[model samples]
Target: MQLTILRSQLLSGLEKVGRAVNSRSTLPVLAHVFLEACDNRLSFFATDLETGIVMPVSAEVKTPGRTTVPAGPFTEYAKTLPTQAELTLTLKDGKLTVKSGASKASFATGDPGDYPPRPTLAEADHTFTLLPGVLKDLLRQTLPVTATDEARAILTGVQFDAAPAQLTLRAADGFRACVAQAGYESLPLAPFQAVVTARSLREVLRLLDGTHPEAVQIIADQQARVAFLLAEGVIVFAQTLAGEYPDVDQVVPKTATTEAVLSVEAFIRACKQMRVAADKPREALGRLDLQNSGANAVKVTAEGEILTASETTLTGDVTVTGQSMQIALNLAFVLDMLEVIKTSHVRLKANAPNTPVVLTPEGVPGLLYVIMPMVGH
Candidate 1:
């Protein structure tokens, strides 16, 4: 492979595809990025078996060929080069040469033919189009709830279900659920529904964000991989988890026995204060007391006396006994949820002391958050 490209362009392309390069893998080839120079453009490709990415950059292709180089070292070296310098890549024998300005480097090359084939979906059987911004917004809202555990493979992926004129993305990690919906002009022909890994989806979104594609083409086949063609410069491949996502709709309660409307900022601050106390305990324990005393206000108290060195007093009257619980939840999770909620006033509801607590915006209809109550001592 021979090509001459601006250093900035080359580095950007490498960084874009680097998201899929496996940092630690048994297969050496998975750690390399495939560089292909053809038709006046150089394309960089990387895959970690489960996820793959391709990014193309403008270059002067003197000879059309392909070579695979270690993705990590190559990216690191390119990033250090001068931005305005011209990068010249050449492949001879089993080695690849990278030259720019006064710096020069050589690396071993692997056969491009051995790289894993990019999966393809039937163009006729499955297809859908979405505005990039809208799709990104939906992912940002829902992807956080996806499980990271490999044992619950289905829960690790985002569930995309389309019907009629609506498309919904749903994700859950047993304890919490998030769902986002958008409208489509027409129903997708094949009803392309699948559970795609959240990690893969997040990587794809990152690539898309870098490119700013106007629209994204999604293609999925039954029992096969899914492909997202963002533009001429980018493509993403992800394997679908082959299991049914749990019935999330059923898990969300339809009625509430106790509901309170309070400021999101206030609730977040109270949670943060409680977290300071919760984190100091060997067995983290924090309590939230909610009571509706009047028409316009509901009381909220977060207390953890076990971890505090001194007694803390509230300036206001107490309306309910401290609803104490010995739950060890990562405080970061609570903070993440608070940041994503899109309203100032949040309505919280709970059916029973042991039941899950649901949070929604005061006037918004679609967004909902359900957090399971901790088993109290």
Candidate 2:
């Protein structure tokens, strides 16, 4: 392979595709980025066998060829070169050489044929288009609720459901669930659903340059075991998780016995202060008391690891008629929902202290979160 490209262009391509490189994989080729110079452009391709990316950058191609080089070292070296400096890359006899102003380096190259081929959605059943901002907003709502626990692979991914009128993103751990939706002009085909790993979508989020509001193409091909996201300069092949996602609509509560409306800002502030006393990162327990007293005060209390305790009352509006209610819940989960909700006011509702608590933004109709309450001592 032989190509001359600006440092900025080269570095950008490498950084984008490098997210798929698994340096510790048993197959050494998985650590390398495959380079193909053709059609007056150089494409960087990398994959960990599960997720993959291809980022094509503008370059002057002298001899069209292909080679693979260590992604980590090549990217690090590119960072040291002067910005916009012209770089020449050539591969021959199993070595790829890099040359720039007053600097030169060579890396061992592997046969491009050994690298995994880019995924194709030949069996795709549904294809849709969305703006970068729309995808990012939908992702932000569900990514936080995805589980890190690998044992339940299904829970570690977000469910993508495409209906006739909307696209919904849903994710859940055992403790909490998040559901967000956006309107999409769906195709005339049947409804489709797929589950994509949160880790893969996170990389897609990073590559989406917000400045360019280009439409992103989404191809859902669960039968082929992959989904393709095509953007301006990059294409992402997201490995689809096997099995069906839980019905999030059933998980959300249908009616609330007690409900209260509170300022998102004030409630989050009080919860953060209460968490400081508990000192538990994941299971910080807090008791929330929502009373429809004439004063409309919501009380929050937390017990510390020691004998200390913290309690604070926040002023809020009680628009619904209900008996006074108290529920013990994980403040960490509550705070996670609060931080992601973009509305000024949040409505908290529950059927009972032990049942699932549904939280939704006051004016937002499509987004909802359901958090299971903590068991009382």
Candidate 3:
């Protein structure tokens, strides 16, 4: 393959597909990028079986061909090359050469025959579109709650339910669950659901920088794979996990015994202070005592641990309905959820000490975060 591409574009395309390269793979070809040059474009592809990324960049192709070269060396060498200049890549005698201005380097090319060829994906059984910003928000809320335990394979992925009107994302890891939905206009004719790996979800999130205004098109097949279509011909695909994700809706209480609205900053601050004291204990547990302080005011006290006792309280806002409640929880759980809440205030709903506590970003519709309470301090 002989092509001249802008240095920055080459570097960007290399870095984008590098995530799927597995240096420790049994097959050496898996560690190298498969490059195909055709029609004045250079396409880079890398896959580790579970996830794959393909990026095509505009280039001047003198002789259209294909080659495989070490991903590590190509990315690192491109960074050292002069920026804002064009990079010439040529394949000769099974060696891939790189040149820019007066500098040049050659890398031993791997046999392209060993690398898995990009499959010809069929017409999607279902498809939908989502703005980058909205999809970004949904991932942030749900990805964290996905179970890391491979035993419950389904929980390790973010479940996408493409209903008639909305696309909902749900994740749960026994202790916590995140359920969020984003609206999409004119969704696919048939409702479909699929669970994409967390690793792929993270890559999609990385791709959606705030600047890009393109709505990401989500394409899904019957069961094997799902691909995220970005601007241009860029596509990110992943193999879906087999099995059914748990239904967390039953644990989500329809009624709350006590509800409190507090400043996000204030609650987060109190949690941080409680963090230091909670970490002193073996299990690092903290307690939240929600009590009615006065008219339109409720006091939230964060109490921590066996090693060093710590407590802080603040009172504020709305009506504190029903009975007072005290919830024992791990401080890190709340802190993680609070950091992602993009709002001035947060609403908390709790039914009982043993039940789940739901925290919703105030004024943000269609988002729910539920954390199961801990047993003992």
TM-score of each: 0.88, 0.95, 0.93
The best candidate in terms of TM-score: 2
How would you encode candidate 3's per-residue C-alpha lDDT over 227-298 as one tens digit per residue? 988876778888898887788787899989899888889888877777776545323467887776555454
Tens-digit lDDT string for candidate 2 (1-377): 78899999898888888889999999999999999999989999999987888889899999999989999999999999998799999887899999998899999988888988877777777788777778888888889899999999999999988887888889999889999988764352567788998888987777775225367778876454545455656888888888878887897889888888888998898889888877665778889988777877789998886737888888744454576789998998999889987888999888888999999999888899999998663
What TM-score does candidate 2 get on C-alpha atoms?
0.95
Query: What clash pairs does model 1 have?
Result: none
Candidate 1 accuracy as lDDT: 0.74
TM-score of 1: 0.88
- What's the best-to-worst order under TM-score? 2, 3, 1
**Any idea what lDDT model 2 has?**
0.84
Residue-level lDDT tens digits of model 1 in 144-193: 88888888889999998876577888888887787677865335776767
Off by over 4 Å in 2: 185-189, 209-211, 226-230, 316-320
Worst 10 residues of 1 by lDDT: 310-319
Give me the displacement of residue 125 in model 2, in angstroms.
2.2
RMSD of 2: 1.8
lDDT scores for all predictions? 0.74, 0.84, 0.82
Ranking under lDDT, best-scoring first? 2, 3, 1
